[model samples]
Target: MGDLGRQLAYWDGAGAAKTFTHPVEHEWLAGVSRAARVLDYGCGYGRVMASLADHGFTELAGVDLAPALVARGRALRPDLAFDVLTDPPAVPRPDGSYDLVLLFAVLTCVPSAAAQRELIAETARLLAPGGLLYVSDLLLQEDERNRARYAAYADAHGTPYGVFETSDGAVCRHHSIDELRSLLGGFELVRERRVEVATMNGHGAQGVQLLVRAR
Candidate 1:
């Protein structure tokens, strides 16, 4: 297959699509109350959007790096709308353009930490005054095994995805939580938490870390 196949395999992997999503996380996000325009950056199969939509958050959008994945996402939800390169990606939205931008699990994908910073800056630019940005991803740690699954993925599709620094000749860059913080400077961090432990075979748990930048 290809990059899209790799992503789809991961998303549709056992227990991830069904058991990984946490309502408390969504409820916590909903606490922002004023959130109207939400951009699900790097949305894979639209699972989070589907959940948010189920909770009455209809003003939703999704963006992904892979066109094949986006195409598949459309097939998964024929009634919903999908967009290009994820929202606010290249030419980001106007300042305070959206009330909330969901960037969950997006930061860790890029090969370089610098790219992560650029992505974060764009995300910050898209936030409205009092708008919030939510992000979650695997944190780099001493244990190399933590990102084994991603490593495997990289080995399978590194060249096609255009990724660099593969642990085993694959595309991968695991960031620690502190590195994540460095990426989002404009927005004040209100809260943070680690959602999974690789030791627990919790890759499906998403290594969740939520940061909200208050307007």
Candidate 2:
């Protein structure tokens, strides 16, 4: 968690790659523009959800686990609704209520695989049938066919980066594609694709994005 804080400081801090508006417009978002009740889970500084609102996604709400960042997000985009959860609840809304759920660059920050599953299950519970959930992040690829994860860039830049903790308990769980897959056991995967190449803290890797539908 400390490492992630430092990374956030590096990336979203003073002079970094881009705004908090990371490219969440992957293939998953492209397919579901009509969704009304959208929740930007793990929202930070509200750039992405603000952008979505700017694009006419009116029914939007942003939630994050960090209170300080959530306050900053509310300040940045006063028009949008913002909620802060020290530890995120199961679902932000009632079951089968949300038309869309977005966890952009959030899962990797999670402490563990069990937390990931809890997030996935909660999202599933909140999603209305045919509702869509969009997830994007830099994950350790199972197949070494491509050197496109943070670890590869970490190896190149000589900077160390990995999941050093899990949300449930214990310590150190390096995030991988398989772990994410295991987390999303109930969702039906619609598509998965690499969105961009991210180099953080002198380390670079491929960013993968996902679009899934509720079962």
Candidate 3:
């Protein structure tokens, strides 16, 4: 969460035009109670929250760092709750406030490993014991195009191997499976699946979705 000024500016400026394509597996959530309190971290414009509501899941709230994105979410989904996160990695709520936490395509936007760890820790703090954490995010790509970008950015900025900068002035990261497992060390894996997803720029990409329960 260090010096997120640039990322914040990018999202506040162009976030409204971006579309998140991470698929929410309703089947995975089938066992969850309809009344369970759910929190959608990095919920841009409430898209996933709306989908959850449509599938009969009630008591959902979303929080995002971008003001414009949160504003747009409130406008689009008036019934859902969306809050702007002025102090990130710290959602203002009591400990164990939520039964489920959604981390949809959020890690990519956070380029630093330390920041990602802090975010995950915050998510864990917000969840009740044995609560679920659903994560949908990009996996490192083997294709030449992605490889080249990864190398270029790593060489130029000295960021991690899978971290890269987009043409749209935003820095993002794709994670390895091992890295993700290390990040979620406190959680026990419940279910996992590999899926194809569209990037905000509409490019086809490989992604992993995980449903884990707090230990």
What are the lDDT scores of the predictions, listed in order? Answer: 0.60, 0.63, 0.92
**Model 2 clash tally, residue pairs:** 6
User: Per-residue lDDT for 1-215 in model 2, tens only?
Assistant: 23323334332343222334348563345555644899888787787787788676778988765666767777778898988654454544678878988887776565444556667778888889988888877665344433343355456544335543222221222356666666665788888776555522333455777787888
Q: Kindly report which residue stretches of model 2 are placed more than 4 angstroms away from their true locations once superposed.
A: 1-21, 26-35, 141-162, 165-174, 197-202
Off by over 4 Å in 1: 1-24, 86-88, 142-170, 197-206
User: TM-score for model 1?
Assistant: 0.71
Q: Model 1's lDDT to the true fold?
A: 0.60
Off by over 4 Å in 3: 3-6
- The candidate that wins on lDDT is 3
Expressed as tens digits, the lDDT of each residue in 24-77 for candidate 1 is 376567575533888888776676788777777867888775566666778888
Q: Candidate 1 vs candidate 3: which has greater TM-score?
A: 3
How much lDDT does candidate 2 score?
Answer: 0.63
Per-residue lDDT of model 3, residues 27-60, tens digit only: 9999999999999999999999999999998899
Query: Against the hidden reference, what TM-scores do the models get?
Result: 0.71, 0.72, 0.97
